[model samples]
Each structure stands twice: as C-alpha cells, then as structure tokens.
Target: MSITEKAHRRSSRSLKALFGVLFATIVLGVTLAGGMSPATAAETPTPAPAPTEESDFTNTYSIGGVLRNGDEVLEGVDITVEGDGFSETATSDEAGEWEVVVPGKAEYTVTLEVSTLPDGVELRNPDAASSVVTADQWLTTSITRSFPMGEDTRETTGFGAQLLQRLVSGLNFGLLIALAAIGITLIFGTTGLNNFAHGEMVTFGAIVAWIFAVLLGVNIFVAMAIALVFGGAFGWVQDALLWKPLRRKGVKLVQAMIVSIGLAIVLRYLYLYFIGGETKAMNVGLSEAVQLGPVRITVASIISMVISVVVLVLVGLFLTRTRIGKATRAVSDNPSLAAASGIDVDRIIRIVWVIAGALAALAGVMLALYRQVSWDMGFQILLLMFAAVTLGGLGSAYGALVGSIVVGLFVELSTLFIPADLKYAAALVVLILVLLVRPQGILGRRERIG
Candidate 1:
C-alpha cells in the first residue's frame, strides 16, 4: 500500500478507538449520575424545547435520525418512543435513518435498542432516570426534528439499563423458584415416589414462619429457624405415619404418587383453612444494597443465595462422604438390592424425608423473606418445580440443581425482550424445546433415558 493510504487507515483506526472510549465514558456518566442501571440504557428522553405561547393540537410529529457511533451509521436498530401516554416505534433503514410520527405537544423518549451490544461498548439511556420531563415550547405543526445519534457507547452491559433490569428480575424469579424446585428434585432423586405433597410441605413452612413472626413476637431469624425445624418434623411425621407403611405394604410407585397427591390437597386446604388466603410479608426490613460493579444486590437476596449454596454443599458432602449417605444412594439406585445387601433402607427413607422436609422449609422461608408469603405459594411454584426436574432429568440431585439454575436464569432474563407477564411461558417453551432436542436434559445421564 502507498504510504499516504497506510497513514490514512491508521488514523481512522485510532480515531474510531478513541470515539468508542469516549462514548462509553459518556454513557456511564449519564446513567450513574442519574442512578439508573446500565441495563436500562437507550432510555434517553427528548430535550424539551423552550416554552412558547400557544399550544397546538397535533396527533403526530415526524422524527428522523441517523443511528451512528461516531462517523459510522448503525443499521437495523430499533427506535421507540415513550411518555405523553402514547408511543410510536420505528427501525433504522439500510442507510441507518429512521423516522416515526409520534404524538405531539408532550415530550417523548427516543430510544435505540438492539438485542445485543457491540463489544467493549455500553450505553445508558438517560430516560431510565427518575428525572421528569416537561415541554417548554411547542413543535411547529408537522415539524421534523433530527437527532444526531452519537457513536456506540462504551458499556459492560452492552444493551445498557434494560439489561440491568432484566438481570435483577431474572435473579429474583430464579431465587424464588429455586427454593421449592431444589427440594422437589432432591426428594425425587432419593426416593422412587413422586411426592405431590411436597408443595404442602413448602406451604406449611411459610405459614409456620408467619405464625412465629406475627404471634410469637420472635425475631425474624428465630421465627425462620422455628419454621425450618417444624417443617423437618412435619416431613418425618408424614413418612412415619403414611409413606413408610405404604412402602412396607409393597404399594406400587404410582399408588404412592397418587397418595401423595391426595395428601397434598388435604394438607394444602388445611393450611388455607387455618391461615386464610391473605398475603403476609416476612416483616424483616432489608434496606441495603451490596454494589458489585454495575449490579446492585440486596442483603436479603445475598443471604438467600448464600444459604442455598451452603446447604447444597453440605448436602453434597453428606451424600458423598458419610456412610449413611452412601446407604441412601444405594437405596435410591435399587431398593431391593440395597435391602438384600443389609443396608437399612427404611432408615435411609426416613432420613431422606427429614432432609427433603428441611430443604423444603428452607426454600419456603427464603422465598417468604424475599417476597410475600401467600396461602398458595406452593401451588404457584409447582409447575416450575416440574419443569426443573424434567429439565435436569428425573431422579438426579446434581441434575436438579443445574436444571433449576438454568431455568431460573433464563426465565428471569427473558423479561428484557418479553413482557413480564409472559416470562413464565418462555420458561415452559424452553423446557419443551430442551426436552425435544435432548430428552435426557442438559445434565441428565444417557443411561437414565427411556
């Protein structure tokens, strides 16, 4: 290449790099200054014009812009409007110009949204801030405004403030569902019966926790402990009184499952009869955010996550290292063989019940602490639990854990593109697709496949 041509290319590259850095800095400043999360980027409100005398009624005003990052125009970008209680949308053409006829008189937000952000660049939307907007001037009837969209902004969350909202929402949903799904998966792995009553077990824990907090006047932590203990105890009693005898009678696995379903209904309404259908808060105030980079997490959420991790670790150790744990695994693998080999299958079953009950209670208490406790909390999570188990492969604790995390994260993240109301539907759809593609589940063993 000629010297002049090489020099020109080098200068262009350097300028592009500098512009990228500048864009990121500006975006960060704009979002952080406004206390808006980076995920919600592309939320810039229109800079209102200076107020003039008369207000003109116009149904729409034309807006056009070259979506660009520095000197380059970005193609295939989505632009949306908000505020004025009405919205209009448009997409950039091949030349990166977009036009929309938006409702006039009131100011509106113009946002640049795309599914993924360009590498090493993040932009924050100014509109996500709590700042209010008011028009100081009226647009000339049928006036056209052109905004010179700047270079792609530098960012960690490439999509900006919208991504942050999605992360938080997903984390919330995943954490909530994990509480119950984990327990269901654990119990199923250890025992052959599908315990439909597991849902009631969770509800019982929440109601008991509520009782302690409301009537006993105990500290929330203490109340939670009480719930956990009582929940474990309930599981023990159910095994001793119902499941154990049924097993001894050589009842079919399907029969045991049916019995569990009946027990679930009985126990569920009994809880409802006593507690009613009202929603109750945990009443423990969690007021601080633990900032990690661009993401802010609350104390309650951190605590819940920590507790789950610790419990799962302990469960892992108990199952792998302890003698009793070995026996439990043996029974799960083959009950008749384990019994014939002198492993105490009945004792293992009882212990499994206790563990399942404890985990269920813990999930219930954590969920209640993070959100509201309701009479139907268990039922609300039942389908999700089924999805996790099916996704993780039936009868695998490790699979369940892995599956729950996947389901939880995806369902939560879907909120970015999907309406919040339809997030659960996305999860089910993903679950069905996963099943079709890999019937054994993500972590399920090939041997376990039908």
Candidate 2:
C-alpha cells in the first residue's frame, strides 16, 4: 500500500525472476555438457579417451612453410625431414608450402638438398642448409629459411625483439589476473565476506570447459560459455545454501572466514580426486603464432586479452552507471543504512556472488588455455589473486584491476633478472613493498586500524 511496501514487493518479484532465469540457464548448461539434449541424446557420440603424461605421441607432428625466392613464391622444392627412427620426404606444392608430420618428439634434421634447388637460388645460410629441429612437446614449430636473390642472410631474433615478446606475454597474463581479481574485489565489497573458495570457482570453470569441450565434443567457445553460466549458477547456489544461512545465524566474520577455508580445502582435493593430478590440455589444438611488429603471440592469447579488456570495461560501466550498481555501491559503503533506505542488501550480495563466480570462471578458462589445466591450477593462482585484491585495496573493484595488472607484469618481467620459478615470489615481494609505502593499498582508502 505504501511507497516502502511497494518497493519491497517489487524487489522481491525481481529477485524471484532472476533466480528462475538462472536456474533455467544452469539446467541448459548441464544438459549440453552431458550431451543429453533431446535432439542429440539418441545419437550422442562416445568421448575420446583422455591422454596421460605417459601417453605415447600417436598424433602426427607437422611443420611447413611457403618458400619465397625474393618476391616470388618458389614451388617443387624438395623438403626432407629426417629424425631418429623416422624419415619423411615431400615436395613443395604450387604454393611453395611443404609439411611433414613426424610420429613422435625426436631430434629431427630438416635438409634442403642443394641438388633440388633451382639454379641461382642457393641456400643463404650454410648453417641452415642442414638445420636440426627438435620437435619436443610442442604440437608444431615453424621453420623459416632464407633464400634471397642476392647475398642477404637471415639473422636470429635480437634482444630487443625478445624483450618485446616478454612484454606482450606479460600483458596477456596480467589481463587474466585482472579478470579474476575483479570478482574477488566485488564479492568483498558487497558481502564483507572473504571467500577462500573463490579459487576453486576458477578451477571449476576450466574443468567444466574441459569436460564439455574435450569429453562431450561441444565447440570450445560454446563449452566456455556453458562453463561461465555454470560458474554463476554455482555461486548463486553457494550463497543461497551456505553463506545466507550462516549470516542469518549471526556468525562472526572470522568464523565465517574459517568456514570458507574449510570449504576450499574440501573442494580442492575433491577436484584432484575426480580430475586426477595429471595436467589436461584443451581440445583446441596448437595455434600458429601471429607476428605484430617486433612481437609474436598466439591467436588465443590475443583473443583472451581483448575479451578481458571488454568485459572489465563493461563491469566498470555497470558499477558506475546502472541503478542496481549504485545500490550495490551504497550497500558496500554502509549495509545497515542502505537497508534502512530500501536497498535490498541481501539481494545485492547475491548478485555480487553470481558476478564474482562468472568472472573467476572466465579467468580460469583463460589461465588453462595459457597454461595447462590441472587440479592445483586454481590453488597456484590463489595467492596472487589475494595479493592483487590486497594491493589494490580490499574492497575496491578498480583497485583490484590495477593491482592485478601490476602483479601480472611483475611476475612476468621479474623473470628477466631472477629464476623463472621465483617469479611468483617476486610479485609477493612487490606487494609487500607497495604495502609498506601505502598501507591502505594503491587505491584503498586509509581506514581506522584499531
């Protein structure tokens, strides 16, 4: 009847509608992941067996390229690839391209026999005349040979080019960290609950994507979408079933934090038990490198960076410009006051949980693509996510973004001077130094310490 009562009624209706939509989306995701859609259920194909660390390289390895004689593409040139226990020979097609798939990872010698070359098209590098290419774990490697019309020769990549390559890699890594850190900061802002199990949410995304993409034969992009939806659903269920009741029971923040730690432990080992300890690769096979100026990167890494930037910008806009976003900010500032002013604090917290889960899952997917998927993948990055949030400021989303990017770059670029294994430690060291200089964090407001 009154304005206050009407607002409460409207909010309740909206909340119910949100829950219903989320539930439907989750069900559809599960069905797709299971390969049980009504249209495909009857003809669902059996999944291929998973690969193990000791699994033999049954898949063929291939390497080829377009051979150019100055500005003209050369053709009909013999490209011989010979290795221990394997040998293959092929002639270049009309396009001047040649490829060979070796059976396994072995030291291979690729030779361009001088007899088969066209007249006056001599090998530019005598060293590359019989080049050795060791095909290791990588799915493929490119071979670029020089055959200039004149006496110009090929040169190795310079130090400046290598530095630029590392910089691009750092940017890619930093963007992924930013994606996950934003979710952590958002949840902390709205609920004031430190979620230790947040890293598990990241693992959940990768694992689900692996299952759907690799096992169920879903398209990789579709599988990632399903994983994101499932992650959001998992968050909603977690809040509805666990944190909501705990809050209603008046559990102290410290006690709740302890509970989250326990939950995290349970989820981590459960993932190990089911997924096993071996690292899992995505179904998407190797991608060729794309050169940009002085740096070269994979297509996946570039796409991940682009997606991270777009999603983060959208989130920033949502937090600043939308009605619910303003209300969420109000609740984060003062829960009791916001509640008294007709803001549904619990609803806002629930929304935050969903958003946090989705973002973390997306981060996990990107991480898995960059690295490999393993049970402890999320655990490994958990500390970095915390550092990002702490360094950015505990409850500031923008601060988390800034902190994550800095940490990502620090972890990557530090490898230049220190051992690669100590890169993570270097990031932590930076975090400590930043805290000493500005205890409130880079963007964190100074709060009462007592």
Candidate 3:
C-alpha cells in the first residue's frame, strides 16, 4: 500500500477511539446521577430557601433615654440595663442622652444609678430610683425610660385638701375596681369558677392599648375601643379553648379554679417575657388636674369615671333587660334547671365570659392611665378584686358594684390614718368585718352547706 493510504487508516482508528471515549463519559455521568441518594440530591441548589421571619433574626435593640431636669440637660448620669448574666452601662452624654445596645429580646432591669447623679439632683420619687425596662422590643422605635428628677411636694398639701383629693382618687379607683369586680361576679355566678387569671385579662387590655396608643401611634380613644373589642374576643377564646372544654371533661370546679391560677401564672410570665416588667405610660400627653373647691383631679380621671359609670349602667341594663342577660341569671341560679328550660347554658356562660373580659379590659385601660401599665399591674390589684367580689356577695353583680366602691374609698381614705403600705391590710380588715356580719354577702342568698 502507498504511504498516504497508511496515514489515512491510522487517522480513522484515532477518530474512532475519540468517539468511544466521549460515549463512555456520557454513560458514566448518567450512572452517577441515577445512583445519587436523596440527601445528596438535596444538596444541589434547585430551589432556594425561604426568607426567615423577623423574629428569627437577631438585631440590636437600643435601650436609651434622656436625663433632664426641666430644660437643663443633666450629664454624667449612669444608666444600666441588665438581663440574665448580661449587663451594660451607659453614661449620659453632653446632650443628656444615654443609650445601651443589647442583643435579642428579653426582660431587663434598666436602673438609673442614683449615686451617679449630680450633687443638687435627686430622683423625684425615691421609690422609683430604678425601673425595669425591656430590651429588644418589637415594633417600637423608642425605648426611652425616664426618671423624674425633682422634689415631690405631694405631702405638703393641707390636711383637708389632701382628704378631698384622696376622696376623688378613691372614687376613681373604686369605679375601676367595680368594673373588674362586676365581671368576676358575673363569671363566678354563671360558672362557679374563681378565675384568678382575670387579672391577666386586665393586663391584656392595657397591653393592647399600649400597643395601639403608644407603639403603633393610634389615637388613645381608638386604642381603647380596640382594647375593649379584643378583650371580649379574648374572653370568648378562653371559654372556647380552655374553660368550656374542661367543663365537658367533667373537671370539678375546684380543679378548674386551680387551672385558672396556673393560667394566671403562665400568662403573667408570658407578659413579662414579651413586654418585660416595665411600667409603660400608655398616652404621652398629660391632662391638667381640675380643681373643684379643695379637690384636685385630672380631666382624664373625670373621663374615666364617666366611661366606667356608663359601661356599668349598660351592663346593668344588659343583665336586667336583654334575653341573654336573663338567661345568664337563670343559669347562674340553677344551670341544670335553666338547661332543662330549653336554655343553652353553655351559650349564656360564654356570653358572660365575653362581658367579663371586656369589662376587665376597660378597667385595665383606665388603671393604666391612673398608674402606668405594668406586666404585673393586674396581679397587684388581684387582692382588691377578690375583696370587692367577697364584699359584694357571691354571684351578685349589684353587690360587686357596691362592694368595690366601698373597698376603694376605704383603701384610699384609710391612708389618712394608716401608713400607705398598711392601707391594704386595713381594707382586708373591713372585708373580714363585713364577712363576719354577713357571710352570705350583701346581696347573696343564704344557701345551706351540704
């Protein structure tokens, strides 16, 4: 054969070898893909991961405030915010501003170091030398907590003026107490359950209002309306999720009461966990105190009293005139008898819960205005609530109204004679006296103990 013909044959063999190598590579790739485990296949990026929730992310929450005495900026003041082995301190800058940035969300103690104050400066209320504030708050841009630095001349007023003021304060306080007492009374009458968690209901209202009025910058009255609606819904939810189910499960009233206590504890802690133990003043603006002779009370107090009275009156009308109200009363009197009379006892009880929740929440909002809203504000007044209920007599709405007023007046007025701290004890003493005189309560009927 010629040299050219030999070269062409060699070229053909090389070309065939290249094609065979390419086919082997393709087959090998297919085999590897087919043999791959699901776990390994998942590693291949076909679908991207979804974005994480805002709560899942860790962001810096700034805890800061200004230290000012009237128009004067007070510098060199040290503020500390501490939580669970983490502590940070910040000194006021030249502009009287101080800030401490913390990681994550948690309840923290924000203390105004009184020792660091200037020689002439002092906290207005020594009792409020330190405040417990939250770190890493959600949906709130401002985390400023202020400590008033001035002399409190509240005690310098004349005796009679103080008395008149106390009376006004008592009236306002009593009305709020009445609102809560009436709710508890209605619930107890219908269900025979001592809902210790009712206080949390109050707190829930206040917190809701705070979220709307303070955090979200909604109007105060609008926030209050939202709070009332939410409060009622919260009550309905409680019955649906917890109380009603337990009732069907044949749980005893005593066990149900215990459950209420546990629920209260859990809710209180949850509030603390989320909102911290801080006292938040819901509305920013302050209403001037109206002077009536020797008496002095805020315009806000008057509005609150008016609102409380109107709501109470409405509640009274509801119980007496409405079909559901009468049904509730009938159920409270005798659940089995009511049920036999073609009344849905569960429905009436649920309505009562809704009313109770709404009323408690309204009271909470007013209380928040009177004294700033706190995580344990409701729990603090739980004793007074029980007292009011007991004083009025069990299962009597009118009695609760009367009892709460009397208790509220006695508590505030007693401060004139007793130490402010001992006033609660004084109120309890009166409750005991009332109980001794009438164990059946002011309005309660005498029922024989089996």
Instruction: Compare the candidates by TM-score and give the number of the best one.
Output: 2
Top lDDT prediction, candidate number: 3
Candidate 3: tens digits of C-alpha lDDT, residues 8-87 = 88656644543443354356445654664334345667785655785543355777889988778999999998986789
Local distance difference test scores for all models: 0.71, 0.81, 0.85
Which residue runs does candidate 1 get wrong by more than 4 Å?
1-158, 168-176, 287-291, 448-450
State the displacement of the C-alpha of residue 171, model 1, in Å, after optimal TM-score superposition.
4.3
**Which 10-residue window of candidate 3 scores lowest in summed lDDT?**
17-26
Regions of candidate 3 where Cα sits further than 4 Å from its true position: 1-156
Candidate 3 local distance difference test against the native: 0.85
Q: What's the TM-score of each model vs. the native?
A: 0.63, 0.67, 0.67
Report the lDDT tens digits of candidate 1 across residue range 384-439: 77888889888777777777777778877887788979877888899999999999
Quick one: ranking by TM-score, best first? Answer: 2, 3, 1
Question: Which tens-of-lDDT digit does each residue in 1-450 have in candidate 2?
Answer: 999998788667655544554465456456554654333344769999887668745554665666777666778888888878788887878877788876666777877766777777866665566767765535453444343333665668877887788788888898898888888888888778888889999999999999988888888788889989999998898888778866775656786787778677767876775677889977475355788998888877887898889999999999999998999899889999999999999999999899989998999888888897999888899999999999999999999999998998888888777899999999999999999999989999988878
TM-score for candidate 1? 0.63
Give the CA lDDT, 0 to 100, for residue 332 in model 2.
85
